[model samples]
Target: MSLQYFAGAACRALTARKDGPSLYEVCDPILRQPGSGGDPHLSKFYRTALGNPALRTLLRRAGLPELNDPARLNALRQALVLARDNPTPDWESVGGPIAELVDGITLQHPAPPRRTGAVAMPPAAEIDRVIRACGADLLGSYGRNGFIPTYAAFNLIGDPDIRGREVLMALQGLDARGYKNSTLMFNLARVFIARSPAAAVINPPWRGIAEPMWEPVQIRHRSAYYDAFFTEALLSYLETGLASSEQTGTARAAIAAMVDFCLETSREEVRGADGKSYHVVTALAPPPHPRFSRFFTQIKQDLGFGVYVPDCDTTACSFSAATQAGSNDPILDQPLVDFYAGYQVRAGGNEPRVTVPINDNIDYEGGVATWIDSMAGERPYGNDLDPTLNLDVLEVSFRNLTRWQILETEARLAFIRRIVGFQQRLVLSGAFADPRAHIYYLPELYCAYFGRCYHAFMALPPAARQAIDPGGAFELIRLRVLAYVEDELVGREMNPFDAALALIALGHLGGNEASFAPAVHCIVTAFGEGGRRHPYRAYEWNKMKTPTRILVGGPEVTSAFVLMGLALARRCR
Candidate 1:
């Protein structure tokens, strides 16, 4: 019998065996007793099949031919067990036998064909209507800085009413749920608040909503990119106030606290058990206190954010000569010597420094965190991870600030521009476009970014396209990606996430006219054969069914760009 039949019959055998030749027909059973047949091994295997439909299908399809030899079943079962270890598989490694069963099923039960032809976009009037509607719906949800119960009293409402007392309450749950990326929300809100006419006078409800999420940024051991949003938000807040006479003093004080924290916590000077001291670098470079001082000076004048460190100011010194090894000697290689002199050295003049390749400290090895840890000191990993104010941290700290003194409209606009500018230069520049362009054997959110840049360009005047050519830029990028996917080195199938993003990009670049047929062809081929059914609609695609849950936007890359693309298509249609 097939495994499906055997499993079904085996289940039936527990009761009502008299009705059928075997225990095959027992769909509806009359239970005389409470207990089960209780075959532990069979029960375990049955439970496994019930729990995993994909496994059951593969196993059932294999049937008696494979299971007749018990060892093969055992081997298959072991593979199934190992498959569970990787819940979200990286590739199609677990699909050899499963593919056979799936293909057989496809032959037996033909599925419906996929839709083709240009999907119509809503008209310009409709898009404007929706955009206005969305804006109106969202406007009421925001306050100066944070969300407040509609009923909160005046003191609870605090200054800049958006940020005041309401922010403190929201901070508790800011990162409580799956919303781990509160920093983004906070900074986005801060930008809006700094520039918003209403928000300048009061914080915004989203500010309070975003503050507590900044807790992780103080982790000096982590990359500086983590807290970049907070830094931008705080800078925006300060600059906005600086432009206004009323709130400038408070903004400067906040900025000072942030700069002080960055300068103090980022340096690593520690004393070993012996009398000797060890000095380490922890920042992008060494302590830029003087540079930071100048940066603050410029900020005090309200110039704007710029890179503080041009080069490492840490005392440039050489490693001890005694540590050179056979062929692996770093000292022998001048480039390597220059790069890692501080991380390597001979302990004693006579003793060989290179006994083994391992560095002195195992836990805090001189990897990415090494430089930052050196600046932060010995208690880098533990609770001593500065739980205080950097410019970013101040954004969170001031989240608890109930009253925010309001400012003028022009001041607010300048504030947001400065923050966006800071983020653009310092943080977003590294991640401006789709990062997936670097790695795409398996596709990600390239299409998303493609859509965004396209949307932005399309929104500009038709003449603007002549200069910016955002659409053409996206087309070139999309072509490059298609080339990479077709490469022999990347033998990966496009999942639904990739397909959705690709469709968006292609649809945007292609538009209503048939001029974009080539891009459209790329999308269809990536997902299906001649717009027929897709072969692999596996779990990854199933998980991607909900847009909000799959990723912050899509796995493609740039959120701002992708959002813009989707919005533009929706709007322009």
Candidate 2:
């Protein structure tokens, strides 16, 4: 499960406060309980690395205090809290002393300085120039790697949420050449082509002994899920004639790879209700996280070693892009709508088994399930459901169905109602801080996608819009997210990525040009001001278990999102 207990040791080793994720946010272990049969492997050490005597002995020998040293941990935690409240121009380092756990892995630039202040918004013409420049940034974001690459700090803590555990790669973002050239692979397979990471990553400050996840080689992983979203964004801008013919051609070819991946990786004979079977797209090709073998990820999907299964989020994104590109339209081949519809949890028999606290009050009668595989190889698989996945499925399904002129269908209504129910019980409830919200995303991102779909639907004729969202449910959610975006604009400290998401959500559904100015003013202050585009991490870690979990994204996707927000915001006012 979660080796979160190790956060203390990691923090202590890094000479960080015995509290917080200064090193790595209490890490989830990398080791899997390997086997094909029933749940195996016990031992407190497997559950929490601190329980291992050998590891504990190392900590003790290294003169590290008890990991459960409550008083000291809380003191350190409070110190960090105080430091954050009093951030300086350059975020002053709070680290105590470096603990050299691994030789040759000495680090620097792991923690980025806090970005504050505001930048003047450019004039309309200048904004256009800025947008074009941002577009260049977006295009330049794609490296020799053919797609956006995700960076995990060499420290095992996957997400590295800097709020508590801050570290930024020194050679982050694009090099002097105007594209990211540095990537550190934990896997032996050098799938991505980039420069080796400098000795300079601020490794979780090591003041004492710390254990690292001893993961083996990883396989070739082209993140088709991420590519689908980026390709769709590129495809949209391609119509503006912004790219050179050669760049356009290159863009088209990359789009082809994503389409091919989605089509080829689609799992066949996936069972629906009553012995019905259908072809379906899964999140990953074979292993969701190529850091592990197919055997490992397969078992992990079954909660064998990981938290996420082949879920509907990847399916929605991949299928939506493919549909937009006119690649593979398999909706007609199988009972596509019917297959997805059957997965919807009903009030009683079909209702999702409410496992998460967020959905505890909401009856999951019409909600969509996240994981798609109903069964695999004589074993029951697939039951991780969430409300955001419903929004994703609903919007994509509506858009794709409308595209094919298959608007009037029971399944369409089901998808629409699912998010309606979600908005009522979840968003309106202001329980937005639900722990599960960040399971797969930083909460604000859900708003961006929700607004994206709403924007598309609103652009249609009034009659079409009415027919699509007659209940005005989607409108309510849109307003809720829009209001949230407007509200976030005034916050003291804003995550640049969250601000980018806010700009996106606000841009899609129009309020006023005035509302957009503030966040944009704040965001650009951190956007490549003095020189190169620094990597402002989005803090995306599944924070769940599985073979190996690494938070994805670097400056490429961040720049792409900011650029998209800026470009789309132009249509406002």
Residue-by-residue lDDT tens digits, candidate 2, 1-573: 125634554444334223222121211222223223312222111333223343333222222232246664454334333322332212123221111111112222122234345545556565455455555665665545555544332233223222111111211211111000111111100100001111112122321111111222122244557667777767755755666787788668777766766656544347776567666666555554233446534533332223223556767777777877877555434434566676676666664433322234344567666665535532122244566666667666665665545357765555556556765567776644343343345456667777777766676678766665677876677677777666543333455555667678887867556667655665555555314553332333222211113445545565566666766766663
Look at candidate 1 and tell me the lDDT of residue 238. 35
In candidate 1, position 130 carries an lDDT of: 29
Backbone clash total, candidate 2: 23
**How many steric overlaps are in each model, in order?**
35, 23
Runs off by more than 4 Å, candidate 2 = 1-119, 123-143, 151-220, 266-268, 287-309, 331-335, 351-363, 374-382, 403-407, 433-438, 529-550
Candidate 2, RMSD to the unseen true structure: 13.7
Best by lDDT: 2
Expressed as tens digits, the lDDT of each residue in 1-573 for candidate 1 is 235644554343223212111111110021111114321222232232122343222222212232345564444334333333333322133332322222221101111133335433334454334223222222222222121001101111111212212222222212211121121122212322222232212221211000111111111111122122122223333322212443345334433433323333333454322334544223332333322334344432221112222111121111110110112222222222122223222233222222211111121111111111232242211110010011121122122111221122333222322322322232122222222111111123333333333444455456533432323543454454434322211123332333334435544544433322222232323332211211111111111100011111111111112222224344333
Tell me how far the alpha carbon of residue 453 in candidate 1 is from the true structure, in angstroms, after superposition: 6.3
